[model samples]
Target: MSTVEVLASVDIVALRMAPEAQHLQVLLHRREREPHAGQWALPGVIVNGRTPDTSLEAAAERALREKTQVVPCYMEQVGTEGNAFRDPRGWSLSTYYLALLEPGQVVEGEQLAFFDLDSVLARKVLLPFDHNLLVELARERLAAKTVYSSLPLYLLAEKFTVLDALGAVQACLGQAVNNTSLRKRLERLRERGWVRDTGEKNQPRLGRPQQLYQHTPQGGRAFMFERSLLPEGV
Candidate 1:
């Protein structure tokens, strides 16, 4: 009987706000070693007996810090993949985690690069080891969860303008969001105590001064969306 070796690993899908690109970007690192050398891939770590007491979350944290020197403020388990052919070395199982990092917080190295959602979806860049599929799944989750949960807050500044909020939502949904509809949603969110006006305004170069808002202490409430809110832009 041929015995297969089973190993466990973790992969992170870190998203960040990219104002310069006017969208969100996913963090990826270039694989320097073999198997998929010179290809962009998600940062991951091998799980072994060395960190016996360390939980999966802790392991992921350690992995991100060690591999990329980036730490996310928000993280949640997405799912797991255990295709026997996934790893060339042996049968490996990877537990995927979705993490969110604020812009200006990440320090990018020569090996690390951020690719915008549109470019990623367009396959303009190369991604190996099923990393592209992982990104798509993570993006879907972000879009679906934003309708209910305040997950997009992680992609915004501490104090943000209405456009900032809307842009974040648009990046997640990958659709053309109606400005008026988004403003109404923000107002409704404030009325529900999910967010609060900060009494500040952002002076834009083109438009008039806009009010700033912040998530309330009891924000990020998870609910359900009754209807499709995003337009078919993509």
Candidate 2:
């Protein structure tokens, strides 16, 4: 055997709250070309070695911008999957990313459809190129992080109530998070000066006012806790 070429690609799992704010959603678009044409899949792009995309993260950003026009506030590498069978064209590898987004993160016309993660997790929808597995991986990674970190805050508005914070975690985790654990997490953030009470409350039609909290961490870093909110796969 002489040699073979293994191409590289980047896939993104951009997640946010659904339009109705009832569930977590992932961005997907129908493939325009063959090998999986017309099938809805995660936004992805082939890396061009001759270009300025010198890193997988850069290619990931380009894929995100070109496919969804969304610049997320937080994104992380999920993992790499490179095998002769993952793609039809030839041997290839893909480095997938998990992005946490908020409403209004879309800067232009968004052609990507938001699919409820619940549906995907339930196997109601099927994706090609082993993307379903990638989605599963991203889901677990996000849920694990949410258990002990403030990554879910990226899905929340700048100012939110304690309920909002907990809701964000539950939405991302796809499971009810322990309220006491989350409250203590917030308290820890406050102690670390990462978040603070804004001294304001939301005015509702009937319910009493609820205290507000604001994330104050300057950089885009999630404050970590000493323990996990839930055991892995819990």
Which candidate comes out best when scored by TM-score? 2
Whole-model lDDT per candidate = 0.77, 0.83
* Clash totals in order: 0, 0
Error of 2 at 38 (Å): 2.0
Model 1: residues with Cα > 4 Å off, grouped in runs:
217-234
- The digit string of per-residue lDDT tens for model 2 on 161-223 reads 888888888987777877888888889898899889899999867889888998887588788
Residue pairs in collision within model 2: none
Where is model 2 poorest over a 10-residue stretch in terms of lDDT?
103-112
User: Per-prediction TM-score, please?
Assistant: 0.86, 0.90
Model 2 clash number: 0
Model 1: residue 200 alpha-carbon error in angstroms = 1.0
* Candidate 2 local Cα displacement, residue 44, angstroms: 1.2
